[model samples]
Target: MVVCFVCGNMTAGSNVTQLFSRSQRTQQTPFFPFLEYHDPAPGASPMGDDWSVDACFVCDALLAQQWESFERGRMPIGKRLYWLKRPSGCEIRQPVSQIELEEILNEHSRGNLDDYSDDEGGKSPESKPQDPPDDTPRLICYSCGKSDKDCPSMCPVHCKPSYEQLRTGVPYYPTVLDTDKSPGSKVVCESITFLCIGCLPKFPPEWHAVQKDFLRQESTQSVLPRIPLPEVVSCYTCGTDVST
Candidate 1:
């Protein structure tokens, strides 16, 4: 019998059947575009079969530090507190109080809503003042000192037409191409903006590379493989195949 993660119950329901089927599908079947994680029905929290847990970079770092502390026999109080302070966005439970240690077998238990409310109400003594908003356009291309205006020719690198023009579908530049240039060989202005001389891409190359790597890692780590459906087999007592 398979166990449910959320309620810790042994269920012989279709949910467990479906989970095993999904696992088989991942191992044997081809990939489908539409397949994705489906949440349990409203008010019906399934056990170990459907739910999954994924860790972010911050959580992974915190876990590593905590593990080290465990090895040293000196529990890291700060690391534990950091996890308690934020939402994990996971179905897994977390220990909320010392009293739970006696009742719970797992290291992590479901966090108490009451504890969260108490933490929010208690304010730290060293809160900093909020900063005022800066009216100036925040984005400034390194190649050009001038702030990108809400115009077609604003950007030097990407030919991003003004946001207003894009939304309104109004032509910002009369024509993208210069009249003097040759027909086929001439540079055609698709959008009004001038190209950026230095770093024109939306983000710096290094930052983009880092972002892509992070996305790849996150996707691989977080995506759970689907199980395949069980084969239709006839019961020994009956001739007819049993439907799930």
Candidate 2:
């Protein structure tokens, strides 16, 4: 199900999608669809890094106006538009004025922006937990987006990855519970591991056997530890160039 990030109006239908340049051409008549937000990598195509957001048609139009007014000719829809700052010198990474959008849509569209809302049947909303504002990279539960702040007792579980990726980068992340701890059998001394919160109870049991087969395919694979372990073999003599 697609949900409008601004007004919180969700629909069962697929979202509308169009190119960035095309939307620029139809400035006054921007396509009103559930747009997807993307922060293009640095040095992407020209104008690719412009700040954009995923919003419904109504919200997108509002965002477009705000963007064009502030940026003159640019529409803040699918780019990294700005690096907002606060009075105390703390930087804020607000992609757009989401609060204003909520206020505007409160009287127009479905303004049920609460992600944790429940239905009349007492069922929880399908919305996923939103990430906290602090952007510092850290391990989080793969199932639920909980961090050490909430799920302090997380476990480390490795998920099997393509034979190629296994050669590089540590895939270990924190999982909230032990059930979501481990996935496939150990492959390549180190591969991608999942840190879920009991969300996967024997979830990828199929991978257990698949990884076993990987063992046969390759006998020896290098292990790349995410955190370096204490040196097992160090120079016995201080700064020795040759062993005597």
All candidates: TM-score: 0.17, 0.18
Candidate 1 regions with alpha-carbon error over 4 angstroms: 1-123, 138-149, 157-244
80 Cα displacement, candidate 2 (Å): 60
- Candidate 2: list runs displaced more than 4 Å: 1-137, 161-193, 207-244
> Using lDDT as the measure, which candidate wins?
2
lDDT, candidate 1, 67-92, per-residue tens = 45553553322233222223233343
Cα deviation in Å at residue 54, candidate 1? Answer: 30
Q: Which 10 successive residues of model 1 have the least lDDT summed? A: 29-38
Score candidate 2 by lDDT: 0.41
Cα displacement (angstroms), candidate 2, residue 159, comes to: 3.1
Report the error of model 1 at residue 140, Å: 9.0
